[model samples]
Target: MSNTMRILGAPNLYLQGPGAIERIADIVANLGKCALLVADPTVERMLTPQLTKLLTSVGVAFASAPLVGEVTPANVARLAGDHRADVVIAAGGGKGIDAGKAVSRAMSARLVTLPTAASNDGPTSRIFIFYDDDHKLLSAERVPRNPDAVIVDTQILAGAPRHLLVSGIGDALVKRYEAAQCVGAGRPNMFGGRATLAAVSLANVCEQVLREHAVDALAVAGSGKPDESFEKVIEACILLAGLGFEGSGLSIAHAMTRGLSALPATAEALHGRQVAYALLVQFVLENRSAAFMADQFAFYAAVGLPTSLAELGLPKPSADDLRTISSLTHKAPHTRNFERPLSEDELTEAMLQLEQMRQHSAG
Candidate 1:
């Protein structure tokens, strides 16, 4: 409906659920022969048997990149120069996915993302978060190309830690709020400024479904029931949320997250974990009616997500830390759109307020 905006996303297909990776052969049948598989050692070990079996069965050529930590521009530069692979397959959690996207972007190769954990929405996006060797935030760079396909295997996901699944639920919750704010201001941006109405709708639908199904789906994801609620939440988090953020736009919830990562304690947490905590800050900044904010708080509680800074492992971000965060955010491309422009004092207050919420809830 927003003709003034532009919509963009993955070009080919996205598959979800268990055994989805088994179908990778069909998804990238003829694009290339030598495929580069990118993941950390732990994930490589966990997925190698199945991945190798599948690739061999399909007669696909292969190479490998053993991921360490904090994928940087240097890593991308490395992969581009030495890979024998003509295609790139990013597997594992968000970190591995970011690394793989970097390789694909650097090499100008076709990329396919197969997420083993439902921890964050990064798997389907066009931007990859760059970090320093110490895992410090550097910047988030846009891939020259979005993924060709997204392959989600539920069995792989089912095997991931329960904490990650819950984190995914938390990240999924922000879709509606992010989209609504962007639309309300008549502002549109997509992956690097190509926002679209379809993308907004995509995010909206994901948010609603996550709200309705999060509890039940998390139960099923935790247990193994084919809960309708679980399905919707999973789809929204992995599919719609990815499309929405990348194709439509991102605002404060994520902007706040990027800023928070400057603090060492927060950076060590999972991306979804950080985002979930920031969502609470966003709610407070917006000054939503108590009823609305409470509903969101309840959602995080229902999914066992961290809604407070303490829960996110940063109960006491020092004034220096707060100032550092503000400095990082001051010129961040995404900072301009915040409904409430943030200052260091405000961010510091939000951080302390989060600590108070945790203490209040605990006592």
Candidate 2:
């Protein structure tokens, strides 16, 4: 038997429900004396007053920082700006939360993420992604540990745009397949340790939850109301998917993001939408059965996820374009987490096959 060590990375505390943001003061007080809250402009406008009142009630000294534009080292440093708080509260969408993670790392402060939208699973994981000004992915780095807490206020999430919720479902749906591939290949997780059973379980459950509740949740999303299905999908997107990917690692589905981001045609697409299309490429690479592919395509259609290259804004990519994407994808480390080594030629060929499959499905 192989004796590889297994590890699971997760936040210290996870709270999810309607109005969970109200408990932020008590949670912050438990973690540290003072707090630094980081938020994007929209969230700052909507929530700053409410959060300030809560923290003030508990006498938790706190300051606010605006998370603007992309997350870069310089931007994060500017936001941190000599503020020395013991705890950092990252509140808003994914970018806002990511800004908080960067600031917390810069200041060596504890982190508490209060995500307003379930756009992606960055909140509960230690990984913080950085991007260039053009919005291409620069790097993904981890803090010394995961956040002290991840607070998901479903009321806030439900009030977000329906498209954001759909993007999150698209992101969460791929975790099970990615985790299975990584574990089957005996790959080290993001923590550089073997995958634990808990990680695998969470990955499987994440996908199951998404498949079961995503459609129902989408119906209620953006209505400014929370329901059972919406709540479950939110947890799957923010918590289970976060732990699953960080603990079991990513594969071709995530690796392709590097290539997709490099192209202007797809560069500005939402991260989860990119992943959704890339997942179709992954299925082609894996040579999944036609029946399985058909079922997944049906699901994508129902959820309004992009199914064709044209839908992703690349209507007629040149051969050189395919080569550029394949070359960059081949260079990504996680691309090797598949069942076998993937050549650039194979990557390009898989994309072409995916296009053909899309045509056939449409026909």
Candidate 3:
């Protein structure tokens, strides 16, 4: 691809809805005959039987690889050991799905992601983020292409912990501003090409869908029945956000994840929640208008997303903590995807300013 070329990568087939899982056999059968199923423990207990039954009915031989712990290289290697398959079906949350991706890559097999929760946008994209045994952010590896199929069963998603769906909303909401920042700064997308018009448009629509339906969707989530609003939000969180970030690139909102993961106080928080808080720092760095910041804070409060260091479970961060976060954040390449290069001092100031603004907004 040329330097100026625009790129957009996505799953060849994307499926979502109440019974989307039912279509897995047909989808898998099209891709391969032998399948390796990688699932987290919860998904294994909840959905594996039904999935195996579906695949068995279609005469697709399969083996189960139960994923426990982080998606470390060692863990992925252990999971992939002697379990050859034509395709790997990864089912569950981001870690399990990412593990499946790594396993497929190790075995040189195709990958299909079945996300049980709309927690983040790791499903449709080719990139899979794996961490160390300590849960620190590790290398982000990319497959030759995006997933062959991305199956999102909305009923299963609706049954996920309500906070996870809210976290999805938090994660999806930042695509608009982040994409604009990346494009404005002439940064390459994750694919190392210019952001496509389609990506920018989808990023806008993803934010709009969240703004319109997130509250209503949260109201009905975990009822074990997904409403229309719930479905739209899931699509925004999983597909739109996935495509947007991969095709248009990321900026400060995502860069903050690096720092957040490094800190002990905030490291255990969910990815979407960490990103949501990081978006606030991005707003501060951009010098967003007071009204805009306030509106965002209000939206975050409504959606159960964190708005302050305290809310992120770090009420009183020490100077050393602040330094660690700023230093780590400044080192991230995406931090430069903004309109201007950011200094560690600038990051620290922005975070402190965000805390002040969050306090004022809360009052």
RMSD of each: 2.5, 1.3, 1.2
For each of the candidates, give the backbone clash count: 6, 0, 0
Candidate 2 clashing pairs, residues 3+ apart or interchain: none
In model 1, what lDDT does residue 180 have? 70
lDDT (10s digit) by residue, model 1, range 1-363 = 245646576647778766787898766656788788888878877777777777877888766778876698887787678776768889888888989888888878889998878888888778888888978778878777677888887766766777888888777778777777666655556644546668878888988887777777766664533445656777888888888877766666777766778777877887788777777776766776667766767777888988776676777667787777666656566556566566767766766665665566557
Model 1: worst 10 consecutive residues (lDDT sum): 222-231
lDDT of each: 0.75, 0.89, 0.89
Higher-ranked by TM-score: 1 or 2: 2
Tens digits of lDDT, candidate 2, 1-363: 163989898999999999999999999999888898888888877877887899888988878888778898888988888677989999887798899999999999999999988999999998888998788889988788999999999988999999998888888888999999999998889988999999999999999988888899999999989999998999899888999999998999899988999999988778889899989999998889999999999999988898876888899989998998899999999998889998999999999999999999888
Lowest-scoring 10 consecutive residues by lDDT in candidate 3? 354-363
| Tens digit per residue, CA lDDT, model 3, 1-363 | 248998898899999989899999999999899999888887777877887799989999978888888899999899888688989998887887888889999989999999988888889988888898878998778888899999999988898889888888888998988999999999999999999999999999999999999999999888989999999999999999999999999999988888889987798888899989999899888888998987887788889999887888899998898899999889888998999988999999988998888777657
Off by over 4 Å in 1: 1-3, 192-194, 222-227, 353-363
State, as a TM-score between 0 and 1, how close model 3 is to the true structure. Answer: 0.98
